[model samples]
Target: MSSPSSTLGGSKHAIKLTQGLVALFAFSCGAIVANLYYAQPITELISPSLHMSAGSAGLIVSLTQIGYALGLFFIVPLGDLLENRKLMITTALVSIASLAAASLAHSPGWFLAISLLIGFSSVAVQILIPLAAHLAPDHARGRIVGTIMSGLLLGILLSRPLSSLVADHFGWRFVFAAAAVLMALVTTVLALTIPRRQPEHQATYFELIGSLLHLVRTMPVLRHRALYQGLVFASFSLFWTAVPIELTRHYGLSQSAIALFALVGAIGATSAPVAGRLADAGHSVRATLVALSAATLAYTPALVHPAFGVYGLVVTGIVLDFAAQMNMVLGQREIYALHAASRGRLNALYMTSIFVGGALGSALASPLYERGGWTLVAGAALVFPLIACVHYWFVGRPHAHGRT
Candidate 1:
C-alpha cells in the first residue's frame, strides 16, 4: 500500500468541493459542534449548584448523549426522505431553544431534560456531514471532509477551556446562553447559504427504520465498523469523564487547572483531518486500525499506576482522541461511499451505535473509577478497541464491497 497521505491515490468516487465552500462549511461545523460540548467544562459547577449528587450530576451529560443517539437512529435517516437544507435549519433553531432552556434550568432534573433536547437537536451535524459528502466530487471528499471535521474537532477541544473560563468569571449560565446565541447565528447562516437537496426516500417512518435494520443485518462493513467505533466512543467518554476528578483528587488542582487539562486534550483532536486525507488516499482501513491501536495504547499507563499514570493518561488521551476521530471520519466516509442513496441510513447505523457506547461510558465511568481506581477503568477501555480490531480484521474487511 502507498503512504497514507499519498495525494488522494486517485480514488474516483471520493468527494471534493470548492475551497471557498469548504472553508465556509468547516467554519459552520466548528460553530455547530461547539454547541454540543460547551457544557462539558461546567459539569462540576452545575451539579453542586443545582443540589445534585456527584453521580447524578453526570446525568445531564449522559442524557444529552442519549438524545443524540436517538436523533442519529430516528431523525438523521430522514435526510434521505426530507428536504435537508430546511431540516438542518429547523433543527438548529430547536437546538438554540434547547440551549436556552438548559441555561435557565432551576433544578438538576430540569437541566437533564433540557440537555436531552439540546443533544437531540444537535444532530444537525449528522445531516451536515452526509450532505457534505454528497455535495463534493469524488476525488476530494476526504480533503473536504477533513476540512470540515477540523472545525468540529476544534470546537470539541476548545469548548472545555473556553466554557470553563467563561463560567468561572461570568457564571455557568452565561456559557449556555452564549452558545445559544452562536447557535442562532449558525442556524441563520445555514438557512441562508445552504443549497437544497430534494427528498429521495419516501418510506414511512417504520419503513425507514426497517432500512436501518436491514443495513445492520446485511452490511458487514457497517456492522464491523460500528462495533469498533462504538467502543471507541465509550472509551473516549470514559477517560474524559474521569479526568476531572482525578486531576482534583490526586494533583490537588483547582477547577481552573482541571479545565486547562481538558483543553490540552481537546487540542489533540486536530488530528482528524490528516486522518481523513489518508482515507481519501485509499488507506482508510489501515488508518482505522492504526487509530484504534493508538487509542488502546493510550489507556496503558492508567492501568499500571494511578498517580503517575494520571499524567501519562492525559498525554495518551490526546493521542487516543485523535485516533478515535480519525476512525470516525474514515468509517463514515466508507459508509457514505457505499451507496449515495443510503448515506443517511448508513450514518444512522454508524452513529446510533457510537452514541449508545457514549451513554454507557458516561454511566460506567463513575462506578468503574470508584471500584477499581484508574486501573480497571483504563484496563476496561484498553480491551474494547482490541476486540473491535479482531472482529473487523477477520470478519468484516474480507467480505466488503467497493464504496463510491
Candidate 2:
C-alpha cells in the first residue's frame, strides 16, 4: 500500500525520469528527421545506379520537402484532435514501413512515393517539440527545447555523412533498411516512455487547419513572427543548399571530405539550449532578431573566400543552423505563450511557414548556383533577412494578450 506521500514521490520520480526520456525523445525525433535528408548527399550515388540525371536527383530532395510542407499543413493539425502519443507512434510505424519500401524501390517513382510518406510521418519530431514545451515548467522550457533541438540539428547534419559512409560500405538500399530498424526501436521507446495526454482543443481536423488563415489574419504576433521566421529560414535555405554544391564543384574536394567538414560545423548546433534559456528569461523576440541578423552577416564571409571556403563554409554552417534553431525555439516560445491550450495549431502555422521557405530555398538555389555562382546566391539570401529586420523594426513590440 503506497501512502499519498509515496505516490507523490513516484510522480516526482517520473518527472525526473522524464529527463532521459526527453533526451531520447529528442534523439528519436532527430533520427526520424534524418530519413528525408539521405537522398541529398547521396544523389550522385543514387542517380548512377538508377540511371537518372543530376537535376532529377535534386528533385528527390525537392519532392520530400514538398511532402513535408503538405504534412505540416494537413497531418500535423490532427495532434489537436487526437492523443499525441498515439499519433506519434502510428506515424513512426508508418515511417518505418515507408523506409522499407524506399529500400526496395525499383524506379524513381516508387522511391518518390516512399519519400513522401517518410516526410509525412517525420512530423512526430515537430509534434514532440511543442509537446516538450507544454510538459516542461515555463521557467525551464527554453533549455529543454534547446536540448531537443540540438539532437534534431545533429541528426540533420550527420545524416548526410553517415549515409555516405553506409552507402560506401554497403549499398544505398541497406541505408534505408538500417534506418527502418532504428525507427522501429525508437517507436518502442517512445511508446513506453511518452505519456498519453488528450488534446485540450476540440476543433475538427478541417476546422483546425482552416484556423491557420484566420490566425494569420487576426493574430498580429503570429503573423509578424511567422513572416520573420520565414525570412530567417529562407536565408538558411539559401546558404546550406549552395555551400555543398560550391564545395564540390569549384574546390574540387571529395564528397566524403566535404561531408566531414559539414559534421565539424554541426558543432555549433549545440546552441539550441542556450537560445532556449534566453527565451525562458523573457528575451526571446530580441534574441531571434540578433541571432538571425548575425547569421546573415556570417553568410557574406563564406561567399568571399571561395578558395578557403572550408573555413568560411564551416563557420557559416554553424551560424546558419544555430540561428535557425534559435529562431525556431524563440518562435515556438512565443506561440506557446499565445496559445496555451492550442499548441498543435500554433505549431502547424509556424512549421508550415518555415518548411515552405525551405522548399522555396531548395528551388531557388539550384537555379542561382547553376547560373551565377555563390556571389549571387549569397547576396540573394541576405536580402530577405534585411527585409525582416526592416518590418519588425516598425511593429514595435510583442503583444501582451493571450487566447489560451
Candidate 3:
C-alpha cells in the first residue's frame, strides 16, 4: 500500500497532518458550521422583533439549510476541481459577509435572503472534512475524520444554546454579529494553517456536477449511507425545532433555560470520537447498529406520560443527538473510503441528502407539533430510525456490499 505522502500530489509521501493542524481544522469547522444553527433557538425572538409572521421566521432556518443544500450540490463539488485551501477560504470569506449582512438586516425578507447566503457559504465545513480525510493516512482516516466530526457535531449542538443565551441578553442580531467575528478569526487561521490540496480531477465544472448522478447510480454504499443518515438527521431536525417551542409553551422555560438544555445535549458530541475509533477498528457495522438502535429508542422517553416533563425531553435530546452524531461519523468513514479522488463529491451527496432530510424535519415540526403535540412529532421522528434500522439489518450488511 502507498503512503499518503507517496500517493498525494505524486510526492514521495502523503501530506501528513500535524496535531496542531488537525486542531485548527476542528476549530475552524465548529466556528463556521455554527452559522447554520444559531437561528434555530431564536426563531420566536426573530419573528416578533422583525414584525414577521411566525411562519416566515421559520423560513430563516429553512432558507439557510436550503442554501446549504444548494451550495453542497453546486459549490462543494468544486473542492474536487479546485485547490481545497483556496476554496475553503473563499467560502469562509463569503460566510463572513453574509453573516454580517444578516446581523444588519432590518426586515424579515432581507434577513431571509442573507440567511440563505450564510447557509450556502457554510458548506466550507463539508470541504474541510473531506480535506482532512484526504490528508490522513488510510489507517488513521477514521480517527482523524472522527475528531473533526466531533468538532462539527459540537458546533451543531452548541450553536442553539449559545445563540439562545446571546440573544436572550444582547438581542438575536448580536448572535450573528458575534458569529461574524468568529468566522473572521476562523478564516484567518485556516488561511495560514491549512495545506493546499488540489485534486487530480480535470473535469469541467458542469461535467463535475453531472457526474454526481452517475456516482449516485453506481455506488450502493453511498446510497445506503445517504439514505440512512438523511432519515436520522430529519428526526434530529424535527426534535430540535419543535423542542424550543415545547420548552416555552409547555414548560414555560425561557430562552436561557433552553440554552441549558442545549448545553446538556452537547454531551452527545462524545459519540463522534468513539464512533470514529470504532470504524477504524473495523467495527463500523456494530457501531452503526448501535447508532440506529439508539436513534430508534431516543424518543421513547418523550412518549411516556406527561409527568416525565422536561427530564424526559432532556434525555431524549441527549440520546437523539448521540445517535445522529455516531451514525454520521460511521457513514463518513464508510463513504470516504470508497474512492479517494471522489471524497468531496461523495461528502457533497451524503450531506446534501442529510440536509434535505433536515429540511423535511423542520418543515414538518410546526405542523406535527400543532396537530398532535410532541407525541405526534416523537412518533414521526421514531419511524425514520426504525426504518433505517431495518435497512441496516436486512439490506446494508451482506458482506458482499459494504459495512454500515
Candidate 4:
C-alpha cells in the first residue's frame, strides 16, 4: 500500500495550489512555447531574406517541431530524476541563447540550426506541466493541467498573429529578438518564484530514458492517450501550417490580414480550461469523443467546397484548434493520474508522440499543398482524426469509463 502522504497526494484535501504560482506556470509556458511557432507565419518573410527557396521554407517549422519531439524523448524524462526548478531554469537559458542566435542568423543553415536548439530547449514547458501535477492533488490535477494548457494553447494560437504583426512592422528577425527578451524575463521569474521539486525516483539519465520504453509497453493508457492526442495534433499541425500558405497564396492576404485570421482562432483557446473541468469531473472519455468528432468535422467545410474561400478556412481553424486543445488536456489528465512517481516520464512519452505527429504534419504541409492545393490537404488532414475515432471505438470505448 502507498504511504499516507502518497495517499494524501491523490486527494484534493491534502494539498492545494496557489493561483499565483499556477498563473506563473501558465504565463511562462505561454511565453516559452511561443518560440516554436514564431517561424510558421513568418516563413514567407524569412525564406526570401535568407535567399532560401520557397519549397524548403516549411523545413524551418518542421525542424523545430522535430527538435521538440527529440527533447520530449531525451530531455523531459530528466524531470523524473532531477530538481524541477533548476532544470527549467537551465533549459530556459539555453532557449534564450537559441532565440537570440536565430534573430541574428544570416544563412539558412544557421537559422535552421538555431530553430532546432530553440525547440529542444522549449521542452522546459513540458517539464513545468508535470511539476504542476506533482504539486496538485489528484482531484484538482486535471483543472491545474488544463489551466497550464490554456496558456500553451494561447501561445500556439497567438504566436502566429503576434509573429505576423511583429514581422510586418519590424521584420521577422525582430520577432525572435523580442522573444529572446521575453524569455529572459520568464527565466528570471521562474528562478525567483517557483519552488523546488525533487522527484522520489532515483535513477541515472540512461535508466530514466530506458524506463520510458518499458512504460510504453506496459501501460495501455499511455499508448492510447498518446495515440489519440497524436492524431488530433497532426490534424492541428496540418491545418495551421497549410492555412498560412493558403492565406497568402490563394486569398492574397497581407501579413497583417493573416495575423487577424490567426487572432480569430484564438477564440478556441477557451476550450482548454473547460476540458480540464470536464476531466476533473470524471468525464474524460465523453470529452475525448466529442473532441475527436469536432476535429473530424472541422475539416468538412474545406472539403465540401474547395471554393469555400478564406472564411471557411478560418472556421475550420477555430474548430480544429478547439478540438485539438480539448483532447490534449483530457489526455494529459488521464496520464498524469497513472503514477505519481512517473508523471514526468508519462508526460514525456505522451507529448513526444503528439509532437512526432505534429512534425509529420508540418513536414508534409508544403509538399501536399504544392501538389494538390487545399482540397487535398483538407482530405489528408481529415484522415488522422478519423483514424483516432476508429481506434477509440474499437479499443478505447469500453475502457474509457475507467482508468486503464
Candidate 5:
C-alpha cells in the first residue's frame, strides 16, 4: 500500500483512504478494544481465584470501565496534541504491560490495579478512531467511521465468547496472556502502516484538558448525542455483564455454551456500518429513533427467560447489541462532524460519558442480579434506553431536522 503523504499539518486535502489501511485500522481497533472486554465473561472465574466475594465480582468489569472512562477523559485528548501514530503505539505498549501483569496477578487488589491500567491504555482505540475520522473526507466520514466502528463493535461482541472459550480450556489468566501477545502484534502493525496526523490545535495540555468542559458547555449537539448514547450504552453494559451469570446460574450453561451464546450476539455488530450509511444519507434522526426504540424493547424478552428459555435471552442480546451499536456509530458520526481539529477532544468527551455509564451498569450488575435475579436486571436495563427514547421524543426531534 502507498504511504500517506508526509506529515499532514493543517492540510485542506483529506488523505485518500485505501482499503488496506481501512482493514488495518479495523483490525487494530478490534484487537485493542477487545482488552476492555476479555475480563467481562470471566469475572466469575477470576473472582473466585482472586478471593473476591460473589457480591463484588462485578467490580472486575466496573473497574476496567472506570479506568477506560478515566483514560477517555484524561488521555485520549492528547491525540490532538501528540503525533497520532506514536501516541497510539505508546498507549498500546502500556496496555501490553498491563495485560502481562494481569496474567500474573495473585491478589484481587493487584489484579484490579492492572485492570485499570489495561482500560487506560486501551484508550488507543479511541485515538485510532478519531485519527481515522481526521483522515477521511467529509462525504465519506460517516461510512468510514461506521466501517471502522464495525471492527470495534465486533471486538466488543466477540471478546466475551473468545475469552470464555479460551478460559474454559486454558484458564482465565491465559486469556490475558494471549491478549497481550495479540496486542503486541497489532501495535507493531499499526506503527508501521498507519499514516501520521499532527493536529493544528495549539494549546497547553492543561488548557486542552480544561477546554473539555467548555466544549460540553458550548456544543448542544455534543451534549445531546453523548447523553443519548450514554444511556443506551449503560443498558448494553448491564446486559453483557449480567447475562453470563444469568446463563450460567439460571440456565446451567457451561462456559463453552456461554461462548456460543456470545457468538450469537456478534450478529448485532452488522448494524454498525448500516448505521453509518444512514447517518451519511441524512437519516440519522429516523435511525436514532429506531435504535432507541429497539433498545427499549430488547429487554422485554429477557424478562421472561424462564418461560422462553435461553432463546429469549438470546433475542434480547441480539436486539440490544444491535440498538446500542447502531446508536453508537450514529453518535460518533454526529460528534466527529462538530469539529475537525478537536475530533480527539470531542470523541474524548463523548466516549468518556459512554464508559462512565458503562461503568455504572457493570458496577450494578452483581448486586442487582443477586438481589432480584434476571427480572430486576432486565427491568433496570429496559429503563435506561426507555429514558433516552423519552428525552429524544420530547427534546431531540425538534432540533434533529436542522442537520442535513
Candidate 6:
C-alpha cells in the first residue's frame, strides 16, 4: 500500500490504496449517508410534532431525496473539477449545520427545508466513492468499491433502527441533534485522515455541468445501469416508507419494535461486498439478473400473507435490501470503469436518476397506504423491480463481462 502523503496532487504517482484508508473511507461514507435515513422510521412522530398533515408527511423523506437529486446534479460533479478532500469537508460542514437546524425546526415548512439541505450535503458520499475508485488499481477496484460500499449500505440499513430507537426514547428532535454531533465527529476524523486529490479537469463549472448532457447522450451503460437501479430503488423506498405505517397501524408495533424489525433488515447489507467480488470476477451480468429477480420476488412472502405478521415483512425487507444493494454496487462498479476522467459526472447522472425514483416512491407511500393499504403498496413495489427484470431480459446484453 502506498502512503497517503506519497500521492498528493498528481495523477502520475502510482496510487495504491491501503486497508486502513479503505476502512476510513467506508466509515466516513456510512456515517455521512446515515443522515438521509434517520427520519424514515420516525415520520409519524415528526408529523404530529410539526403539525404536518398525515397525508403530506411523506414529504419529509421525499423532499430530502429531491434535495439529494439536486445536489447530485449540481454538486457531486465538482469532484472532477475541484480539490476533492476540501470539497467533501466543506459539504460535511453544511450537513452538520443542516442536521442541527433540523433538530430545532418547529414548523413543518422549516423542518422540510432543513431536510432538503441534509440530503443535498450528503452527496459528499458520492464524491468519496469515485475518489476510492481513483485510488484503487484496476484489478482490485471492484472489490475496493464493494468493501467501501458495504459500509455505506450498513449506514443506510442501520439508520432506520437507530433513529427509531432514539426517537422512541428521546423524541425525534433528539435524533437529529445526535446525528449532528455524529457528523461533526465524522467530519473531523475524515479531514485528518483523508488524502487530497486535485482533479486534472480544467473546465469551468458551467462546462462541467453542461457536459453531463453529452455524457448521458453517449453512455449506454450509464443509462442502462441508472434505469435498472432507479426502478429497483423506487421499490426499495416504497417498501420501507410504507412498512413503518403498516407495523404501527396493523401490527400495533411500537417504535422500538419497528426498530428491532429494521435491525433484521441490516443483515441484507452483507450482500454488497459479495456483489462487488462477483462484479470483479466477471459475473456482473449474472449478478445483475439475480439482483433484479430477487427484488421482484422479495415481495412474495408479504403478498402471499399480508396479515401473516411481522416475520413475513422481515423476510421482504432482508431480501429487498440485499437485492437493491447488490444491484447498486454492481452498477457503480460498471460505471466507475467507464471513463476515469468523467466518473464524477457519470456518478452524478446515475445517482440523480436513483434519487428521483426514490423521491417518487416516498411521495407515493402515504397516499398508497391510506387509500389501498399494504396490499396496494406491496403490489406497487413488486411492479417496480419486475419492470426492471423485464427490461433487462429483453434489452440487456451479456457483454457486461467485458469492460465498457
**Candidate with the greatest lDDT versus the true structure:** 6
The TM-score of predicted model 6 comes to: 0.96
Candidate 3 residue pairs in backbone clash: 4-14, 5-13, 5-14, 6-13, 6-14
Model 2 stretches with alpha carbons more than 4 Å out:
1-17, 396-404
Cα error, residue 250 of model 1, in Å, equals 1.9
Ten residues in sequence with the least summed lDDT for candidate 2: 1-10
lDDT of 3 by residue, 14-85 (tens): 456888878888878888889999999999998888899977977877888889999999999898888888
Runs of candidate 1 exceeding 4 Å displacement: 1-16, 305-310, 399-404
* lDDT (C-alpha) at residue 99 in model 3: 92
Candidate 1 per-residue lDDT over residues 52-71, each given as its tens digit: 88777867768888988998
lDDT of each: 0.76, 0.74, 0.88, 0.88, 0.88, 0.89
lDDT of 4 by residue, 1-404 (tens): 01222222344244457998899889988988999999999998999999988766889999999999999999998988887888989999999999999999999888888888989999999999987887776677788899999999999899999999999999999999999999999999888877677666778998888898889988888899899999998989988999989989888999999999999998999999999999999888889999999999998888788777888998999999999999999988888877777888999999999999999999889999999999989999999999999999889876554554
lDDT digits (tens) for residues 1-404 of candidate 6 = 12222224455245457899899999889998899999999998999888999766788999999999999999999998988899999999999999999999998889889999999999999989988888888788889999999899889889999999999999999999999999999999988877788877889999999999898888788888899999999999999989999999998999999999999998988998999899889899999999999999999977887676788899999999999999999999998888888888989999999999999998888899999999999999999999999988888755354445
Each model's total of backbone clashes: 8, 1, 5, 0, 0, 0
Query: Against the hidden true structure, what lDDT does model 6 obtain?
Result: 0.89
TM-score of candidate 5 relative to the true fold: 0.96
Q: Give the clashing residue pairs of candidate 2, or none.
A: 142-276
lDDT of 1 at 111: 86
